[model samples]
Target: TGINYEVVALMAIKTELQDHYNVLDNWDINSVDPCSWRMVTCSSDGYVSALGLPSQRLSGKLSPGIGNLTRLQSVLLQNNAISGTIPSTIGRLGMLQTLDMSDNHLTGSIPTSLGDLKNLNYLKLNNNSLSGVLPESLATINGLALVDLSFNNLSGPVPKISARTFSIAGNSMICGVKSGVQPQQSMSRSHRIAIICGATVGSVAFVAIMVGMLLWWRHRRNQQIFFDVNDQYDPEVCLGHLKKYTFKELRASTNNFNSKNILGEGGYGIVYKGFLRDGSIVAVKRLKDYNAVGGEVQFQTEVEVISLAVHRNLLRLIGFCTTECERLLVYPYMPNGSVASQLREHINGKPALDWSRRKMIALGTARGLLYLHEQCDPKIIHRDVKASNVLLDEYFEAIVGDFGLAKLLDHQETHVTTAVRGTVGHIAPEYLSTGQSSEKTDVFGFGVLLVELITGQKALDFGRLANQKGGVLDLVKKLHQEKQLNMMVDKDLGSNYDRVELEEMVQVALLCTQYYPSHRPRMSEVIRMLEGDGLAEKWEASQNVDTPKSVSSELLPLKFTDFAGADESSVGLEAMELSGPR
Candidate 1:
């Protein structure tokens, strides 16, 4: 019966509103359940908990029948043409936390009954035609975090809501209370005229200053300036800087992206080494139009992350170029290339990386990851952490690059649901099955990278190694079990690395790749272990007790050949193969 009441309330709202956009075309009154309807979220116990219908272009008074859904916690109806006063019956919703009816044509004073909703946290009634004194009872809601009542015809003293995020600007008539009483009577006509005259003069002065600044900017924009390699120019705040280059200039730099200028290619894009007019070198990444899913979104994300994230080990984004036919990202050139390329060169009889350089790169990459996970505000999780993404500069220092598949997490959030990303063999087992990513997922990828560094092996080599049929993870575990850990070291690094240090690093990698997310050490802890913190002993003792449980019921063999050239766009098509019924 309560479900029916919720359904009826929803239908009444639909009938009252003039839905010009047909956004609510699916709200059929004949439906048996409103919980399944669009924009209606229900609790596990089958009660309507949230009704979100913002920017729906619907115009009408909010139906008072909404109060009948007593279990409602959030009622969001912003950015609509809805008119009339807010239904006072909404105060009956004791569990309400959010009440957003902003940017509407609603009138009348806010109901004092709203004080009854003690759990309310957000109350937005901005950009409306409401005219009356705001209720003082609103100040009593202790949990309120935001209260926006600007751009309304409300008068009298402002309420002290004690909210950290409060805004009442644009409501010129609103005034503050002093000593718990309203201020004195209105000012004299002459006093008011003087205030207006003063404000007008100040506005005119501000405009004149802005015009002078604009003219100076135009003059600078007309000139060409060259910056040195160490300039560290940032365009976000710096005005009149030559931060952006034309597509024609970039095209000329790479000699039309000739094969000789190509640095590397991957599933998403190809990178080229280019020298600008001033002899400064840069790496130009031209994303493939087909595989760059949400191209504009990815472009903006990469720019934002690279610009905001500044560390010695993080690649610096020089700038970007977006044309009708191309999206190009520019970064400082790394002469040593990527870790993956270096490892491949070692396999091809090039000069092998000494043990010291390998350790240095590992530590540097760990620091970059620590910055992303713990240092940045609203931390970022690099969903695609692999050897290919770790570039090496002139001195062979590691610079963690690539943020196309990155996800942002609030400090209070533990994980986020997203499409499965990353190289097939480097993905964490938990993330692969549940589509949930956290810092541990990045740690898992780093563990795979450790294996790549130690053994000089790819994460997913399809039966390439004569002795190993399973992936690098399986081979490392097998070698560790046999106590022949030295056999897992890169053949090119024979006797070049300390036996004791190699064993310890392998053990740390094993600890990081533990199937259970809770069991894996944080990136910060991993950093400590890399710096000789001696936490490997606890990891070694725990290994005997913790068995690797399968993430799914069936253990299916995944082959690298199956995804040899496929990109992220095709991951969803074959997701079922890697992600079993979990």
Candidate 2:
């Protein structure tokens, strides 16, 4: 009966929250326990112990029934649109240790009942419209280690607290002046007039001198400086667990980026394997074109977006380093290398990736992209989604890396325009001609990635070998129509793959790479079809629609060529052979 109560409470809580992306679709009411739900975690005895759903764009009010989950030790619901007052019943969770409800539209005063949580260690209620005086009861929590109430409408003098870190910045109404401070006396009229006259004269002289100095400095520098001086000083770089390493530290770690330690090179940068002083292995990416006008801006944007996007399948940023002449990002080293390397290279004269691993990689990569496009606050578009950018961890799990060309799209906007970037064969036709990109563009590239996985060959190389003017995609369709897919399978697989699964994967790839971006399915839908849920229905619908012209025939003729005046070695790993209209 107690467990039944917990389920009922969870169901009530779910009713109050909006799930925009069908993320909570699997939270079945008929389930025996709430522990099997997507975001709910349970203890050894099957009591709900945690609820983690961050950056999911969830809206609506938090249900007070959440307090019924007395076993909950942590609750993370940040980077969302949830609003309304904090449920006072939350104070009933005696075991709660971490409570974060930041970056939302929530409005209300801090609940005094929060003080009842004796075991609370971390409390974050920042970036909201929360007002009212700081609760005095908060200072009474003996085990509290951190308290952040920044960027809100909080007012009044702060109470003395024992927490190791406390932030109250951005609250303009906060009174920092202690009690019993005397006010200053007014100045005499004659003294004020004289002071004003003196200040005005001094200001004029200072402006004249400063203007002359600025002209001289500009003449000497000859407009060489592209980035703003203030761009290098982001407080977020040092906040939280992200470290800010010095240039000297990174240089020593990779032996000054020796050629022998190079892991991979792309158009934007080169990745070097580094060994930290703490005896940890790391991959250091040194960006090129750091002196270009928008280089630093791109670097800053990537840092901010990647830091916020936390998922197991996406590459985790360990730290970063930036200097006047150098920009570098640090990530954990992958032992299994990139998917491209594994498929193309062999170890001990045998294929490194088996048929089973290939299917898993495809699904894992889709889930990561799904999170980026649907779950994140500002949807991310990976302009380049190829096998080279999909890395493998020790356990052979796919980790999507390389955010050099990634763009963030607001939920209200559907697309963004920029210069043509990405590999030749992977670039979507619409993106190539119009320079406009959306999540569909990523879907198109992922389709190419799927073909890469199936045939264990590079798209461009396979296209060239086919001798077909319509490129690799056209050849794939031709094979599928003739029931000759077995001939196109990777020779390394040697008839070891499931025939039904191969046909399903091929159909999904064809659907994804359609010439019309509107025809491509969203990553979430693709995931379902891949998992054997809706492929038959979607494929039948696609077949009913008028078949568009071949993917390559719809675009202008393209010829692979090197970027003018670009070092061949500095070209992007996936974009080495860029294509231009010929």
Model 1 regions lying over 4 Å from their true place:
1-242, 290-298, 346-350, 412-418, 462-466, 549-561, 564-582
lDDT of 2 by residue, 1-582 (tens): 434877878888789999888778878777777864666656536788767787888999999999998988768788889999999999899888778898999898998889888878668899999999877777778776568999999998777766757888999999873344544588789998998999999999999999998898667557556443323333333223456787778888999889999999876788999999999999998877665325565666566567555555688787887765678889999999999989977667667888889998998898778767865556788888899999999978888888634667886545745466677678787776667788999999999899999999887777666676676888999999999999778898888899999999999999999888888999978888888989999998898777566776543333433321132122222221223332
Clashing pairs in 1: none
lDDT, each prediction:
0.72, 0.78
Model 1, 414-503: lDDT tens digits are 674645666766778767766777898889889878877887767555224635555456667777788898877788787778887887
Q: What's the C-alpha lDDT at position 434 in model 2?
A: 61
Among the numbered candidates, top lDDT falls to: 2
The TM-score values for the models, in the order shown, are 0.56, 0.74
